[model samples]
Target: MIKLCLQRSLRPAVLLSRSALDPAVTVRKVPIVPHIHSCQMGTRGRNEPREPLNSPKSAKDFIYSLHPKERTCLLMELQSFESIAIAQETLQPTPPTRAQIKYVLFHNSIPFVGFGFLDNAIMIAAGTQIEMSIGITFGISTMAAAALGNLVSDLAGLGLAGYVEALASRLGMQGPDLTPKQADMWQTRVSSHMGKAIGVTIGCILGMFPLFFLSDDDEEEKKKRKAALTAPNA
Candidate 1:
């Protein structure tokens, strides 16, 4: 039997039969492995290029991609430049035209002259009394006081000129011709000047009354002293 078994095992069909007939031999199902094609391995077969992560589509998008500190710095720089430009635009001076200068002078001249005369007159009257009281020369004190009063009047005229120009602009009176709308504006301007001139003139003239009385008393005293000194020996 050993010889026969050995001979059978030497043949392939007898070995298969022997393995099939054995109770301990078992068979297992083989797993199937799918083949991957070259095209599916990567993006080698794609038609479009990939976009970069850092690439932006618009200004707003570019700003969003920056770090928080960098974005804040850039915004601050932009605001600073904007503020500088605005300041430069606002600070630039515009020269006034000749027509505007002429208009100002024409409208303000009468009041300025009237105020100057009244002011000088009052100052001169006051200065005469001061000189009499202090026993100083009338010419020097009167001239100095008149100069100071004229300076004051000139400053006042300058201020009033600016005010009148602003008022005219507010009233919307531009051209030389007066429309119905400008009628009220003209009346207001004229009335203001007239009233100011009248008030200043009357006030200054009245203010000189006390000085006049003092000067009269000083003159009378001087005359009496002179008469007493020049009288013949008695």
Candidate 2:
């Protein structure tokens, strides 16, 4: 049985060897596949050229790849950004301009046409021989008026000079202008005189009224002295 099996296996092997040895047999050429490696298409490390990713598509992926520090910093900066500065709404103070100051001074200096209740009250209060309150108030008012008037007059003088220059130009008559020194001297003179005159005038006027009057006690004291002098030796 073993010999029969060996013969059966060797019969096919002998036939294949005879076929391989045959010179008359024609063999068709199989096409040679090119050695194309998939790995060769992929680039390596940091220097590798990357294709641009589509926007809004791989944005999450790009963000996810960022370092934790960079991600936190970006988020913090975004959170701290303010869209607009909150405005502090406030009322702006309107400072007094030169013209306004002048107008105010001039208005106060000019006598009112009608009897002003306030002015009359002021005058009556000032003229009274009573409390010292009126005197102090009048003094302050006088000083303030004088100071403001001095400033206004100086401004008015300048305005007059301007008007004169305008008129002179119209008349085609040019003249030497006042020097800055002369103008300063004039202003100083006016201010000093106004302040001193106002102060002195008010002082003198207030001084006219005696603050104290002799009471009954003083009169009695005088009478007693006179009676003692006239009395005969006691």
Best by TM-score: 1
Q: State TM-scores per candidate.
A: 0.26, 0.19
Screening candidate 2 with a backbone cut-off below 3 angstroms (N, C-alpha, C), the clashing residue pairs are none
Model 2 lDDT-worst window of ten: 80-89
1-234: candidate 1 lDDT, tens digit per residue: 222222322233333334455657554432322322111111112212234333334344444545555444444433333334333443544434445444533444433344444455555555554544433323345466556545554555444444433443454433333222232354435644664565456546554554545646677775565456556534
Error of 2 at 103 (Å): 15
The Cα local distance difference test for each model comes to 0.43, 0.35
Q: What tens-digit string does per-residue lDDT give for candidate 2 at 7-125?
A: 43234333443445565644443333333221111111211223344454344444455555544443332222210100111333334444443343333222121112222233333
- Point to the candidate with the largest lDDT: 1
Segments of candidate 1 deviating more than 4 angstroms: 1-125, 133-184, 220-234
Clash pairs, model 1 backbone: none
